[model samples]
Target: PFVPLRRITPTELATHGARKNASKIYWTVLEGRVYDITPYLPYHPGGEKELLRVAGKDGTKLFNLTHSWVNWDNMLRGCEVGILVSGNEMPG
Candidate 1:
């Protein structure tokens, strides 16, 4: 089955990112796309704490600075949670 991808707002993305380690699902935004990285935390080569630092926020800068060589698209394939809705418009 091909389920449609979800479109989330920045506010919603922030809320999910704020969950951090306290929530079952830890989310991160990169290049306007949200990904549930909870499962990859333990396996991250840099270690879980490294990823935790940017758990609930945009990690694009950090990610590029630290491991720009990494194939993020392939790495986050199935982990994608949703796409950030365009512009700053918040859902009502």
Candidate 2:
């Protein structure tokens, strides 16, 4: 399922993916389907050119891998950071 970007927040990142004293990172979705997205970070078409934008963060790698069937390829364009907004829709 696709989640809106608005629902994600820095605190969420800190709690979920952002780690302490780490420059490289990415997120993992523990549910809804086992998937890991860490490998795709360096390959992010967005270019690792600007590490500042994603420094000490988890790229929510699970989102891409878990939802591959969703054709989320295009969604990667708008992301300024890696975030995982997994699980079913948030109770509408």
Candidate 3:
């Protein structure tokens, strides 16, 4: 599947994480890179509950706090769907 990457903002990211959303997609940010970690959910060693903490938002701080040992760049791999950018970064 060749999904196009996007420039995601905090608000848009928040929208995707809501349970009410029909998309059922989950995204998380690490080091400014946005990942559709939905595919990795079942594989997470910490279980879905812990990983959900980072859903739909920048998880850099919390991820580093717990999984500082993990190399997110390598872990996220193909899941990366975009880059996290402020709303102002979008071209008008």
Predicted model with the maximum lDDT: 3
Off by over 4 Å in 3: 1-5
Using lDDT as the yardstick, the better of models 1 and 3 is 3
Q: What is candidate 1's lDDT per residue for 1-92, written digit by digit as tens?
A: 99877887766666655344455677888898889998898899999888977776889999999989999889998999988786577555
Candidate RMSDs in Å, in order, are: 2.5, 10.9, 2.9
lDDT against true structure, model 1: 0.81
Collision count for each candidate, in order: 1, 2, 0
lDDT of 3 by residue, 9-72 (tens): 8888887673766788899888899998888889999998888888888899999899799987
Per-residue C-alpha lDDT of model 2 across residues 8-62, encoded as one tens digit per residue: 4344444434345253444333222112244556775655443223433442453
Q: What is the lDDT of residue 3 in candidate 2?
A: 57
lDDT (Cα) of model 2? 0.41
Cα distance off (Å), candidate 1, residue 47: 0.9
User: Higher-TM-score candidate among 2 and 3?
Assistant: 3
Cα error of candidate 2 at position 76, Å: 11
